[model samples]
Target chain A: MREQGRGDRLTALLRRGPLLAVLVLYTLYTTLPFLWVGAMSLRTTAEISADHYGLPSPAHWGKFRAAWVDSNFAGYFWNSTVVVVSAVAIVTVLGAMAAHALARYRFPGNRLIYFVLFSSIIFPPQIVLLSLFQILVNYDLYNTRTGLVLVYVSLQLPLTVFILEAFFARIPQDLFEAARIDGYTDFQIFLRIVVPVGMPAIVTTVILNFVHLWNEYLFAVVLVSDEDLRTLPVGIQRFMGDYFQDIGMIATGVMIAVIPVIVVYAFFSEKLIQGMTAGAVK
Target chain B: MSAPADAARLPAAAAPRRWWPAARRGERDPGAPSWLTLMAFLAPALLLYAGLTAYPVVRTFADSLYDLENMDAPRFVGLAHFVAIWSDETFLRAIRNTLVWSFVAPFLDVATGLLLALCLYAGVPFARFLRIAWFTPVLLSYVVVSILWLWIYNYDWGALNLALRALGLDGWARAWLGESSTALAALMVTHAWKWAGFNMVVCLAALHALPSEVLEAAELDHCGWAAKLRHIIIPMMRPTLLNLYILAFIGKMKVFDLVWIMTQGGPMWSTETVSTYVYKRAFAWNTFDLGYPSAIAVVWFIIVLAAAAVLHLAFRQREKLEY
Candidate 1:
C-alpha cells in the first residue's frame, strides 16, 4: 500500500516514462516502413508524390494485376517457389543425414567433419562467387533453375546441419539401443526413430531453409542469367529500373514478394526466431 | 559462427575448446555406427559442401596466384595479384570503407538491440506484438528493403524529407543515397534497422535465462535499476553480447546486396565494401579475369579471419558466470 502512495506512484511513473516512450517509438520505427509500403501499394503515384499521406482512400487493385501479369512477377514467383522448395527438400534430407551421422556416431573424423561444416558459416558466400561461376559454367549448369537449386542446397546446408545436429545430439541414446535389439539398420533407425522424433527440429530446419533460400539473391543472380530462370529478387531488381517512377507499382511488387514469407512467419514465428539465433541460444 | 555451450566455458581450460562446435558430452558408446555407415550418412552433405564451399575456398586462394585475366591457360604469377591490389588506390578505399562499416554498423545494431531487449524483458506493453513487428524486417529480402529505402531516400518526395519539412527542419533534407559523405552511414542505418531485431531476440533469450534469484537479491538490497543493469545483468550476459557483436561485425564485413541494390557502390564508390568490389572486379569490370578479384577476396578473407580471432582473443577469459 505504501508503494502505491501518490508520491511513490509519481516517482515510478517518472522512472518508467522515458522507457515506455522509447519503446513505442522504436516499435513505430520498425513497423512504419512496412505500413508505408502497404499504404503506397493501394494509392496512386500522383497521390503519393503529392504528399497526400492519408489512408488508402479508394484503394486500387490494378497495380497488383499489372505486377503479376505484365511485369512477369508471376513467372518470378513460380521460379522462386520451385527453386526454394526443391533446394529445401534436398538440403533437408542431406543435412538430416549428415547431422544424423555426426550426432549418433564416434567415427575417427567425426569432430573434423563437424567443424568443417560449422566453420563455413563464417566464410562469406561472396568469396565463392568467382570459382563457383567458373565451375557452373564449365559443368554447363549455368543459367538453369536446377543449377540454382544445387547452389542453394550447398549454400544452405551448413546452417541446416548446425541446428539439426544440436537437436539430434540430445535425443536419448536408449532409442537407438532399443532399435538395435529389434534388428533395425542404421538407415531404418534414421527413418523410423530419428526422423519421427526429430520432426520439430526438422520442420524448424525446413522453415528456416525455405526462408533463407527463398530470399537468396547473390548466387541466383550469378548462377542464373536467363530472364525466364531469374528468381524473384533478381527479376524484381531488373524490372525495377524500368518502372522507376511507379511507386505504387513498386510497392505492389514488394507486397507480392514478401507476403508469402510473412505468412510463413505468421504461422511459425517462434521457430523462425529460434533458427535465426540458432547458435546464440541454448 | 559457433556459440560454444555455456557449460563448455565453465572450466579453466575453456580457451581453445570454446571455439569448437558445440557437441554432445559422453554420448559415445556401443551405439556408435561403423565407419562405412557413418560415411553413408555423411557423404552426400560432405561432397556437396566440399564442392561448393571447401573447394571454392581453396580454388580462390590458388587462382589468386595466377594470371587468369585473359582466358588463356593459367599463368602462375605468384603473389603479384595480391601485391597489386595492395597498391591499388580504389581497392584500399574499399578496405577502409568495409573496416569502418565493420565497426560502426555492429555497434549501432547491438546497441539498438540491447535497448529493445531490456524494454521487452521489463514487460513493456504489447511485448508480443512489438517483438513480432520488430522482427518482420529481418524476413524481408535485400531487394525489397533496398527498393523501399530507395524510395524513402529519394530527393523530391521521400517520406523522410517530407517529415523533416513538416517539422520545419527544411534545410536538413538531402539525397541520402546520393551523397558521398552520408551514403555509407545512411546504408548502415538500414542495415541496423533490418538486423537489430535479430540481436534483440538473442539478447532477450539471454535475459530470460539469467538467474532470477540474483535479481531478487538485488531488489532486496535496493539496488537501483541502472546500477543493477550495469553491475549485474550486463556482466552476466557478456558472452552473448560479445557473440552478437562479433556476428554483426563479420556480417558488415561481408555485406554486398544492400550496397549493390541501393547505390551500386556509387557516388564515387562511397559505399564500396570488399564484397561489392570483388564482385565488380570479377564480373562487371569486363576484364573477365577473376584472378584480381580472387586476390582481393583472399586478402579480405584473411583480414576477416584475423578480426574474428582478435575479437575472440580480446574477449577471452571472461569468468563463466555461475549465478
Candidate 2:
C-alpha cells in the first residue's frame, strides 16, 4: 500500500507538470511588460538607454510630477475625470429610469424600445463617426467638454440600460405593488425603492462606464482638437508625438494614465469582471 | 386576467354575465402604471439615444448618397461613392486587414483565455494572484497599452531587441513596428495581450458555473482528462465560447485605437483598417470628403451586422448541452 501510494503521487506530479509550466510562462508574458514599463518609469532616460533590463540606480520620482505638470497630463486628467464623471452620472440615472419602465410597466412599445436599445450594441461607432462629427459641429458643441459628455452618455446608454434591465427584472413585482398600495407615486416608488434596491447593478454600471469613457480614444481624438480640451488618451498620444525620443518621460505619462485604472481594478476587479461578462454569459 | 380566472373557478350560478371582453382581459391591468408615466420615464433615454446615436446613423446613410465635401452646396450623387469604392485599392486593403484582424485576434484571445481558464479550473497554486496579474493589462487604456508596447518595441533599447542581442541572436533583432511585414502582426499581438485576460475571466466564470455532477459522472466512467474535456467540458462550454467569439469578433472588426496610436495604419498602410481609413477620409485627409467615409462606414456596419447575424444563426440551431 505504501509503494502504490508513492507511485500515485509521482503520476499526479507528472500530470500537473506541463500545466504548471504553461501557467507560469503565461503569467510572465502577461505581467512582464507592465513591470518593465513601471521599472522604466522610475529610471532616467540615460539609465534606460544604458540598460533596458536594469533596475533604476537612483529612482527619479520627479518624472511623474514632470509628466503631470510639464507635459500637461494634469489638464488631460482633469478633462477625462470631468467628462467621464458627468457622463457616468447621467447614463446611470437615465438608464435606471428607462430600465425600470421597461422591466416593470408593460406598455406600448416596451419590447420595441428594449430591442432597439439592445440591438444598438452591435452597431459600431464608426458607422456614425462622420455624421456625428458633422452634427456636433452644426450644433456648435464641438471641442467642448459638454459635447464630449453628451456623446459618451449617448454611446454608453445602451449597455447601461441593457445591464440594468436584467438587474431590474430580477426585482420582485410584489415589492413595487406593495409600495404602490402604500400611496407611493410611480416616480416616488422608482426613486425610493428601485434606486436603493438596484444599487449593486448601479455601481457595476458606474465602474464599467467610468473605465470605458475614461479610456475612450476615437471620439476624443476626432471631436475635440483643442490642446487644453483633449482627454487623457489623446493627450498622451500628442505628448508622445512631441517627446518621441524621451522614453522615460513617455513611460511616466503612460503610468500616470494607467495607474488610476489599475487602482480601480485592484479594488473592484470582481465587480468589473461581473459587469463586463454579464452580458456575454447571459 | 385574474377576474376571468376567478370567474372560471366559480360555480355556474356565481359565474356572472360577461363583464369585460375576454380577449382584452389581460391586456391592461388597472394596477399597472399609466402610459403617460411610462413615457415620462422612457423619454429621456429615448431622446438622447435617438438624437446622438440613431439619428446620426440615419444621417450617415443620407450623407453617403451626396457629395458633401464642398460644404456650401452639396450635389446629390447617389451611389457614386459606393461605386468608386469598388476600385479603390486603399479601401480594399483596409477591408482585407480588418478581415484578418477579425479572424486572427479573436481566435488568439479566446484560445489563450480558454487555456488559462482551464489551468485555473484545475486548481493551480497561486491561481488567484495569476488571474489578477493577467487581468491587469485589460484595465489599462488602449493608449497606455500602446505606449507600453511601443517602449518594448523601441529600436534602440527596447526589451525585446535587447533580449535578442543578449542571447547573441543579434541578426534576429529588427524594428517590429516600422517594417511593413510585421506591423499588423505586432498590432494584433498587443490586442491579444490586452484582451486575453478579459476573455479568461469570462471563461473562468463560465467554467465555475459548470455543474460538478457532470464531471463526477465522467470520472466515474473512468474518463481520462483529455477525454472528459473533449466529450463533456467542450460541449457544455459551447454557449459561452460562442458568445465570447462573437464579442471578440465584433471588437476586432471595429478596432481603431491601437492601430491609430501605434501605427496610424502605417508602414505603407499595411495595417490600415476600415475604421482608420474612414477616419482618414473624413478628417485626416485634406479634402474632408464626408460622403466617401460615410459610404465606407455604412458598408462596414452592414458587414459587422451580417457577421453577427450569421454567427448567431449558426450557433442558435445547436442543441445546448444541459447538465
Candidate 3:
C-alpha cells in the first residue's frame, strides 16, 4: 500500500508538470516589468546608470518626495481624483436617468436612441478629436479644468448608458406596476427602485469609467496645457519626456502614479475584475 | 456579450416612423414614462452628448472638406485633403501598420488569454495567485508601461539583453524599440501583455460558467484530455472567444496611447498609427489645417467599421449560441 501510494504521487506530480511550467512562465512575463520598475524606482541614479539590473543597497527614498513635491505629482494626482470623481458622479446620475428612459419606455425611436448612444463605443473617437479641439479653443475653454471635466462627462456617457441600459432592460414590469399602484411617481421610482436595484451594474460602470478617465491621455494631452491642469497620466508623460536621462526620477514618478492603483487592485481585485469585464462576460 | 446581441437586433427594429407596436395596440404601459418624465430623464444626457460627441463628429466630416489652417479664413478644397493624405508617406505607413497591429495583437491577446484560462482550469500549483498577478499590468498607464520598457529595452544593460548575453546569445540581442524593424512589433507585445489578462478574466468566467455535467459525461465515457478539449471545451467556448476577438480587434483599431507613448511613431514613422498620425499633423506637426488629418480620420473610421463588420460575419459563420 505504501509503495502504491508513492508511485501514484510521483505520477500525479509529473502530470501537473507541463501545465505548471507554462503557468509560472507567463506569470513572470506579466510581473517582471513591475518588479523591474519597482527596483529601478528605489536605486540611485548613479547605481542605475552604472548597471541596469542592480538591487538598491540603501533604496534611496528621496526620489518619491522629489517627484511628489518638486515634480508636482501631488498636484497632478489631485487633479485626476477630482476629475475622475466628478465625471463618474455625473455618469452615474445621468446614466441612470437616460438608461431608465430608454429601457422602460416603449416609445417610438427608443431603439434608435439606444443604438445612436452606443454606436460611439465601436466608432473611433479620434475622428472627432480635432473638431473638439477647435470647439474648445473657440469657446475660450481651451485650458480650463471645467472644460476637461465636461469633456470627460460626454466622452464617458455613451458606455455608461450602454452598460446601464442592459441592466435596466431586464427590470421586471411587475415592480413598476406595483410602484405605480402605491402612488409612486416615475421620478420617485427611478430614485427609489431603479437606482438601488441596478447598483451592481452602476458600480461596474463606475469602476470602468474611473479606470479609463484616470489613465486617459489623448484628451488630457490635447485639451489642457497648464502644468497645474495636467492629470496624472499627462503629468507622468511630461516628467518622462523632460527627465529622460534621470532614470531614478522616471521610475519613481511611475511608481507614484501606479502605487495607488496597485493598492486598490489588491483590495478590490475580485470586484475590479468582475466590474471591468461586466460588459463582456455578463 | 450583451452588446453584440443588441447590435444584432438593431436592423430588425430600427424603423422610427411606427410607434412601438405595444403602444399602437392601445394597451397602456403603466410602467411607461410620461413625455414630461421621459424628456427630463433623457434630455440632459442627449443634450450633452449632442453638444459634444455628435456635433464634433459632424463638424469633423464637414471640416475634412476645407483647409481649416490656423486663423486664416477657411478654404474649401473639396476632397483635396483626402487626395493628399492618401499620397503622403506617413499616412500610408500608418494605414498599413494600424491594420496589421489591429489584427495581430488582438489575435495574440485572445490566444494568450485562452491558454492561461485553460491552465487555470487544468489546475496549477497556485492558481489564485497567478490569476491576480497576471492582471497587474492592465492597471498601469500606457505611459508607465512604455517608460518601463524603455528601461528594459536599454541597449547596454537592459534585462532582456542581459539575459540573452547570459545565455550566450549576444548576437541576437538588439535595440527593440530604437530600430525600425522591431519598433511596431515591440509595441504590439506590450499591448497584448496588458490586455491578455482582461481576456483571461473574461475567458475564465466563461470557463467556470460552463456546465459540469458535460464534463462528467465525458469522464464517464472515458474521454481523454485532448479529445475532451477538442470536441467539447473549445467548441463550447467559441462564442466567448469570438466575442473577445472582436473586442480586442476594435481596441487595437483605436490604438493610440501605447504607440504614442512607447515610440511616438519614431525611427522614421515605423510605429505610426492613424490616431497618432492625425494628432501630430493636426496639433503638433506645423500643419494646423484640420482638413488633412480629418480626411485621414474619416477614411480610417469607415475602414474600422468595415473591418469590424467583416470580422463579425466571418467569425459568426455557421455559429450557434451555446448558452
Candidate 4:
C-alpha cells in the first residue's frame, strides 16, 4: 500500500513537471513581442530588421522624439487625452446615478430599462458606424473632439452602468436608511455616501475607459478626416504606406499609446482585477 | 479622526419615520435641489447616448433604405442593398472568412489559455513572474502588436523565417502571410498570442478560488494525476470556463485590427472580414450599398444576442457549488 502511494506521488510530480515548464516558456513567449516593440522604439530605422534580435548598439533615442514631433504625435496624444478624460468623467457620473436609481428605487419600467441597457452592452459598434458617421457629418460634430467624446460616452455607458449597478446592490441598505433619517435627501445620500464608498469601482471604470478611448482606431480613422484631429492610433497608421518603411517610428507610436495604460495598471492593478472579476468569489 | 463614531452617533434616540419627504428628517426640503442633482448627473450622458449611439444605430437601418448620393435625388431602395449583398462575392468571402475567424480562433485561444493557466497554477517557482510576463502583450495597443507581427512575418528579413532557417527547416520557411490559405491562420495565431494571457489570467483567478480539500481528497484516495484533474478540477471549473468561451467567441467575431494591419484583405481579398469588407464598401468601393453591410452588422448583433441569452439561461440553471 505504501509502495502504491509513493508511485502515485511520483506520477503526479512527473505529470505536473512538463506543464510547469511549458507554462513558464509560453509566458516568456508572450512578453517577447512587447519587449521587441520597446526595443524597436529605441533602435534606429536601419538596425530594426538587422541580425540583432535583442538590443540596438547606438541606442537611437531620437525615434521617440522624432515620432513625437515629426509625426505631430503630440497633437494626437492631446486629442486622445481630452476625448478619453471627458468621456470617462461623463460615463462615471451618469453610470453611477443610473445605477443608484436602479438599485435603490422601485419604479415603473425599471426592469425594462435595465434589460434595454444590458442588451445595449452587446450591440456591436460596427453595426452603427455608417449611420454614426453620417449623423456626425449632419450635426457638424464630425472629426471634432467633442464628437468623439460623445460617441465614447454613449458606447461605454451600458458597461459602466452594468458594473456599477452590481457594485451598488452589494452596499448595505441600512446605510441609506440611516442617511435618510439623518435628514439627508436621496440625492445628497448618493452624492455624499454612495459615491465615496464606490470610489474603487469608479476608478476601475475610469482606467478601463481611458485605455479603451486612447486605443480606439475604428472611429478615429473613419469619422475624422483632418490630420490635426487624429488620435494616436490613427496617427501611427500613417507610418505604413504602399512600400516605404520605417518600423522604428511605428514602434515608437505604439509605445506612446502603451505607456499610459501600463502606468495606470501599475498603480491600480488591484482595482482593475476587482472590476474584471467583479467579486466573482465573493 | 473618530469619523465612524460621529456617524454612529447621528441616528440614535430618534423615532424612525416610515417615509419622510426631505423635511421630516432634520434637513430642509431639497425639492428643486434633488431634481437638479439628478439632472446634473444624467444630462450629459443622456444627450451623448441619444445623439451619438442610439441615433446612429437607428439611422443605420434608415440609411440602408435610401439611395442618397445621386445628383438628382435620394430614392427609396427598400431592402435591395441587403439582397444584393447575399450574392456579392466579396461580401460572401468576407462572411466566410469571419465564420472561420469566429469559430477557430476562440477555441484555440481558450484551449491554450486553459492549459497555460493550469501549468502556472501548479505552485511552480517564479510563477508570479511568469504571470506578469505572459500578461505583458495584452497591455500594448493592437496597432503595435500588429506592426511587430507584420515585420516578423516578412519573407527574407523576418525573425520567424530567420529562426526557421537557423533550425535547418529552410524548406518550411515560406511567406506565412503571403499565401491565401495560411494568411488567415497566421493572423489568428498572432491574435491568440496577444490575447491568450488575458484568458489565462481569468481562468487562473477561477483556479485560485477553488478549495484545497477536494484535491487533497483525490490525492488521499491514491488517484493518479489524470483522474484527479478529470474528476475534481475540470468539473469544478465549468462555469468560468463557459463564460470565457462565450466572451472569446464574441470577441473573435469582431476581429478587425490584426487582420487589417497584417494583410488588409490582401493578395486577393482572401483575408477580408466583415468589418474590413464593410469599411471597403462604404468608403473604398463607394457603391453606398450601406444596407448590405448594415444587414451583416445586424446579423452579427443577433448572434451576440443569442449567445448572451443562452449564457444567461445556463447561468440561471447552474447549481451553485461551494469552493
Compute the DockQ of candidate 2: 0.42
RMSD of 2: 7.5
Please give the lDDT score at residue A138 for candidate 1. Answer: 82
Superposed Cα deviation of residue B165, candidate 3 (Å): 1.3
Question: How well is each residue in A10-38 modelled by candidate 3, as lDDT tens digits?
Answer: 99989888887898789888888888888
Clashing pairs in 3: none
Clashing pairs counted in every model: 0, 0, 0, 0
Ranking by DockQ: 3, 1, 2, 4
Candidate achieving higher DockQ, 2 or 3: 3
lDDT of 4 by residue, B182-206 (tens): 8888898898888787777777877
Q: CAPRI band of model 3?
A: medium
lDDT of 1 by residue, A1-282 (tens): 775798898998898899989987888888788888888888888887776366788888887898899989999999999999999999999999998888888878888888878777778776787899888888889888877888889988987887777767767776677778889998898998778777767877787788777777788888888989889999888888787877778888889998898887899787787666656665
Candidate 4 lDDT, A124-144, residue by residue in tens? 668778888777787898888
All candidates: TM-score: 0.93, 0.92, 0.93, 0.87
Model 3 regions lying over 4 Å from their true place: B1-31, B320-323
- Considering DockQ, which of the candidate structures 3 and 4 is the better prediction for this target? 3
Clashes of 1: 0
